[model samples]
Structures are given as structure tokens and as C-alpha cells.
Target: MIDWNSIAKKFKEADAILIGASNGLSITEGLHLFADNAAFERLFGDFKRKYGLGCILQGMMAGWPSEEEKWAFWTRLIHHYCGQYQPTPVMNDLKAIVGEKDYFVVTSNGEGHFELCGFDPTKIYEIEGNWFTMQCARPCHDTLYSSLEVAEKLSAAEQGGHVPTELVPRCPKCGGPMDIHMGAGQRMIPDTAAQARFQNFLKTYHGKKLVVLELGIGWHNQLIKAPMMRLVASEPNATYVTINLGEIYIADNIKEKSFGLDGRLDELLPALREACEA
Candidate 1:
């Protein structure tokens, strides 16, 4: 059983809150990357029909006949998801719970949720690439560039489910196709700034009053999960809290230092928020 008040108090009094969020948390925020449901159809029905793609993940991987069609699909996706940054109740409640305590987020999701949900960008480390940025396929330069303007234009100019060929974004340095800076390909440039932030996070809170909150992370993506677990185990003052819908568990040895809350994020977040209020 989860001691809600205790978890709340941990957050309330901790010197820092370190968050490791993955696909589950993204789903809770209504950005399901791998889901093919009613909302998928409602949001991306056209792409599904035109490209025979079922989910965002499939549509992204599907090879299009033309760059125009491909970019059309991509622009709409980025615009619908990342272009408009809005705050959700979960984010609001998380902010409320943190209440100005120092926090750092290391997210595998590239949906730009942290920034949109009011989390400071400087404190976030998006290990995966973001939809709002682009890089040269050949990586002519070592830098990543913002693609928000191009995506917005393509989204606005889409007609009959495709963008104009002229609207297709290309590398400024080299006339090559631009790709989202996600972790899909080896060519993807890792965010050095985010790396620095993570190092700083570790340096600042290595052995103090820390709470490592792991939400919706699975074994497949263990970059953040593995490190966070090790941190809690290594630090005597640290506590680890895990909230996973499926396969939720904590090591028996660390049970005293950890709290496991098994349920959907949508269900668990509100419950925990209420607990904090109580």
C-alpha cells in the first residue's frame, strides 16, 4: 500500500524532485505515440486513410511516395502536438506539488511536454529528439535548428492531405532532407545542453534530500530508469517512487527506500494529488 501522505510530505520537504518520465506519462498527457484509437483517428484520420498508417509511430515509419506527402504528414503531426504548448491538469498538479522546489526532468518523450506544461526548459533533458526541431539528414553542420516556422507553414498550407513541395524543409547548409532530432537514427545529434543539465543535476543533488520519481517508464527504455534506481540505492537520504500501470514493482531490498504505486497515470496522478491536498 502506498502512503499517500508520506509521498506528499516527501515531495513537500525534499530538496529536489528528479523526474524520469517516459511513454506512460506521455499517454497520460494525451500524447499517445504508439496508440491507434479513436483519438488517433480523430486527430490523424487523413494520414491513416492516405498512407494506410494506423498510429503516429507507424505513420512516422511509413515510407511515403513523395517528400510532399511525407512532409505533409510530419508538419500536421508536429503542429497538432507540439506547435501549441498547453498546460494540462496533471502538469498543473505536479507544479503545485513541487511548489518551487528544485526539480529536473529527464524525459525520453520528444513531445515538448515539459516546456509546454510550464516546466523550465533549462532544467529538462530531452534525451530523445523533439518534434519542434530539425537537423540535416547528412548532418552537414553539428548544430540542430528549430523547425517550428516551417512546420507551421506546412500545416497551414496543407491541402487535400498534403503540403506543397516548395514547403518541404531542407538543410540550410546542404540541400538535403531535414529530419526530426529524435533518437531513432544514429545520425541524430544528442542535446549537449541537456547532458550538461543532467550532470549538473547529479552534482547538485548527489547525496542530499532527494526524491526520484519514475513515472510510466519500462525496461525497454532504461536510460533514465536504471540511473535513477542506482541513485536511490546509492544514496541513504534518497527515496524512489514508481508509478507504473503495468508490471509495477520495486526491489525487495529497496522496499524501505522505495514506494510503488501501481495504476494508470491518469488514475494515479489525481489520487496522489488528492493525497497531497489531504
Candidate 2:
């Protein structure tokens, strides 16, 4: 039902493009968000017995109002998603197209898929923070430190049906708890280096015919989406392209310049690629 030919035609005319990824895009690539693996289900049968929840993902999302519980859930999620995952072909293709031009990626996805797919780190602005890194839970610094090694250890321990005491992540210098670099609450720490790069990217390039290509982004977190949409709307030649599974809506003012497609990225991207080349 989505028109890939029209979308590709628009992209071909744009000078720059921005792509944002969300949970739905990740789900399309065989990543189970809430479903427990056989090992986890076996080890933590009590989790299912007590919560009657399908898996840890659902339970965490369901019980995330409390800060402490939310941090625990995010820690586990960040550990698995960033360290153990690889980008899908759709992600790679999007990166390739954007790479051909003067482009930037601003994604709410914490999975670091943009970087994994070869998007220049300097051009990708992660508004949701990254899962591959950890910062002081208190956010003593603006820096984000890598957690890949610790995440691997935790994932291995979880897969082995045991929690390794030494694998528990903690601040290296302070001996305090370490958490994912997220924009939640008062402790949110944005990566200073990434932020600087984002600013530089914006400053160095402005007034160009830009295209903001949003993929699977939802209204649940407006902090990132709203601001990015505003940025795109402010530019005269800017166009906003939103590709979602079911939710497809655009602002009335920019409706003429926007393309809202209700479809999966896996199918749509390939068609767009072929069309663009043609």
C-alpha cells in the first residue's frame, strides 16, 4: 500500500537525509523485545509464575514507573541490545544511501544500529542514548564509557543460566552503580563528544535541501521526535518522510512536503533502493 517509487523520487532530489529507527524496526529483524529465551525461562521460572508475564521485556515495560526497577530493566536491555546485536540489511541499506550524501542520522533507537551499519559516528546523534556505553548513575561527567565487555559478560552469564557476581557493572572509579546513558529523569547524561559533533554537523551544514526520514518512530517519546520534527519543519526546502508500520500522521502545515508510509522498513527500503538507482 506504500508508494516506494514516489518516496525514492523524493529522496533522489533531496540534498541530505536523516533516518530515525524505533522499536518496531528492531522487531522486524528477529529481535524479541520481551520474549524470554529458553534458558532465561528455565532459570527464572518464578518470574513467569509471579508476574504471569510473557517475558522480561514485557515485565520491565509494565513495571518501569519506579526508577530503581526501571534502571535494572534498562541495564539488562542495554547490555543485550548494544553488545550482542548486529544491524539488519535494511539498516545497512539506509546507512549506505545516506552515506552517499551530506547526511546526518538522529535516531531514538538506543541500539547503536547507525554506527554498526557504518554511519559516521560524528553524523549520528543518539537522542535516546546508547546501550553500548554506561555513565555514572548520578552522571558525574558528561562522558559515556563503553560497556561492551561488561555487557558481553552479563549476557554470557545469563545465557549460561547464572549471574556472574563479577560481571555486575559498577562505576570503575567510584564503586557506585553504573547505568545506561539515557535521557530519563535528572541523571540523564548526554555524550559530550557526540553532542559536540552534532552541533558541528548542524553548524557546518544549514540551509540545504534536507530530508528527515523517520522510521518506526512513535509518540511515546516526544522529547526526541518533536524537536527533530520542528527542526525539519523550520527549513524551507526540508522534507519529512515517515515510514511506520501502522501509525502514519504528519503535521498539517508540512503535510504537502511530507510522505507518510504505513509499511515495514525491510520491504520498503529494498524497493526504494532499486527505484533510486533506476
Per-candidate RMSD vs. true structure?
1.8, 4.1
Error of 2 at 137 (Å): 2.1
Question: Runs in model 1 with CA error above 4 Å?
Answer: none
TM-score of each: 0.93, 0.79
TM-score of 1: 0.93
lDDT of 1: 0.82
lDDT of 1 at 265: 74
Candidate 1 residue 112 C-alpha distance from true site, Å: 0.4
Q: Identify the candidate with maximal lDDT.
A: 1
Write model 1 residue lDDT over 127-219, tens digit each, in one string: 877877888877888778887788888888998777887778888898888887772378888899889988898889877999888889985
Give lDDT tens digits, candidate 2, residues 1-278.
Answer: 65667777778887777666677776666555555767446534654665565765565335333334444444455565565567778876676666478877767666776787677888877776766777877655555778666656555455322344465566776777676665333577766676787667666657877778887777554855676678777877778888778878677778878888778878877776777777
Clash count, one per candidate: 1, 0
